[model samples]
Target: MDSREMPEPVSGHWPKRSSDAADHHPHVDLRPDGVTVRLPTPEVDWPSECDVTLARQISQAARELDVPADPAALQHLNVAVDALVIPEVLPFWRALLGDRDKGPEDLIDPHGHGPSLWFQQTDARRTGRNRLHVDVSVPHDQAEARIAAALAAGGRLVTDQNAPTWWALADAEGKEARVATWLGRD
Candidate 1:
């Protein structure tokens, strides 16, 4: 059966597309809370020349679905924590949080109720500050816009050592988070 016939969803609507054309579209993730419409790489600056093209394609596909597109409900988030000893300490966190292994360095809430936890490898632990850092993964195309939005809200850029992938930023009080993208990651 095609995606449309996968089953009428109980919560979220999928943007309809022809089975052959489906490969060109973003994925629609149906969750208990809401739905996330995501591309392999997020497009942040909507209305840009490139984004406009993508937007049109999505709009067309969404129109075919006969469902009102709700861009407002389309944001996805992931939390990442930097760690000095992933091999030694990951197990502790897994047991404490009752998380299951997603990979060699990641743990996930099997029920999808909690933010996904990814352990980033770091050489040394931070001295005074907390070692845990939050990483917000968005569609790759949305990274710039998300970063700009954060900065506009008083978040400071800590480092852009990795661009189009992740940008380390801190809040007014220096609490840290990174706006991440799937680019260069997979």
Candidate 2:
């Protein structure tokens, strides 16, 4: 079947693009609760040390809000965690990734997603979050339509950044998400 017959989905909406075209759009949802979560945009000037500090900051803020930051909230990423591949999880994911699993560290998604949803090993784990998150990116022209599609797919508009060419989108459960349209690597 042509890709048009099987367009990829963001969250749950049927986006208006071929599966190949959707690759240029990446959406990562940090949905702790399974359905909704807040989306976190990549720190443009990302530093290795930031994850730890950011986790701490989120925890402290959660205390102020009377809601604790579940370690899973700070741990699990909707996308691939690290470039390193765990042989343990690779086989299952390999089958899922199909021909894309040509090598370790190669990004793979059975769903025609943007990047390899890396499962970075972590120490802490906790209950799921109340919100779901997604990182979405599409072609410049497809940006608005893609965002609208996300809204149709049980998503809610969270935030947007005009300069960096990204939009922070979320689901109905207050989950975090991002919509970024950029050149695809694969």
Candidate 3:
């Protein structure tokens, strides 16, 4: 929630954080072990809708202890994830967000209220661990249009049996993304 939407505690005391926007700085280490970690937090002024979804992702991971997190802590935190895809994934998500293309190789939420995911071009196919990935859900009728849009932009189509309900899709380099259709539903 933005400062406006953050509910005050029953005691009516909220953290005295300033009104300045949060900066999603990259994690780096000047320490001896040289360990670095990016802490995922909500960017200030983020759209409530996007923040809500990100909070759900954070909470899901937190519940499984996959990541030590507090959804509440995400308030005013700026978090960004980069996706190095074959360009096609960008338009798919842009369309999903009902956003116009931001640039030749990038798209940003118009409101500047959501985490900025940078989609980059890289030659290496995704191997063992993905630093980041993306997924989407679309109506069945819109699936082909979505895929076509992605392909036109630079994405490739893929399918995997383990995931039966949705068509598996990937970038031209084999880095995977997904499109699940809301078809035959209640």
Candidate 4:
């Protein structure tokens, strides 16, 4: 089936394309909460035609089996490190993290088992705050709920200027995390 005809996810397990197109073979992780499905690398930022076809097949099979999905639980996590000069620090992280594949400003785990590492460029180094933070990317429809849940759990809203796309939040102790979504991304 084509992308236009692809079915919705059956059990919160919609297939997402890998960031790198060179890697083939879907990666399926069975977690206590649910399964996470990643389609073989796509040719572009989004899933390719073949990836969609495969997703449709997977969805169909899941439907046939009456599997349920919890879309709210779907999320992708990554670590972000602020760097004044990426090139100067990239190698250290690359070597320390093993042989992760490098993107323009990120290091991705080739095996898809670890959280991707993104390097954020900064003009000036800020004092008294951690240079690294965790970014949690959830489905667009679930971003608000997740943010609210974090707030309820003692996290404060650091910034919502990028709302609907991302919100910077901090724990009571000031450790930061970002709740993000695909919205506002092209």
How does each model score on TM-score? 0.65, 0.34, 0.29, 0.74
lDDT of 3 by residue, 1-186 (tens): 222232334112211111112322222222332222223333322233333343344345333433333222121222123455646577776787668445665555555445344465666655663545554544345556666777788877766453323565668776666554433322
Q: Give the TM-score of candidate 4.
A: 0.74
The residue-by-residue lDDT of candidate 1 on 1-186, one tens digit each, is: 123423356223334443224444545666544445544332221223333355557556555655455443344456667787788888998898886767788776665456667787988778766677787766566788888999999999999998877899998888888887656653
lDDT string for model 4 (7-57, tens) is 345233343332134335567766554565666342333345555566556
Q: Please give the distance, in angstroms, between residue 51's alpha carbon in candidate 4 and its true position after superposition.
A: 7.9
Error of 2 at 4 (Å): 15
Evaluation by lDDT, superior candidate among 2 and 4: 4
Task: Report the Cα lDDT for candidate 2.
Answer: 0.43
Candidates in order have lDDT scores of 0.62, 0.43, 0.43, 0.71
TM-score, structure 2 vs. true:
0.34
Best by lDDT: 4
lDDT of 2 at 65: 38
For model 1, give the 10-residue run with minimal summed lDDT: 40-49
Query: CA shift at 182, candidate 3, in angstroms?
Result: 2.4
Runs in model 3 deviating more than 4 A are 1-131, 160-164, 184-186
Clashes of each: 9, 33, 5, 3
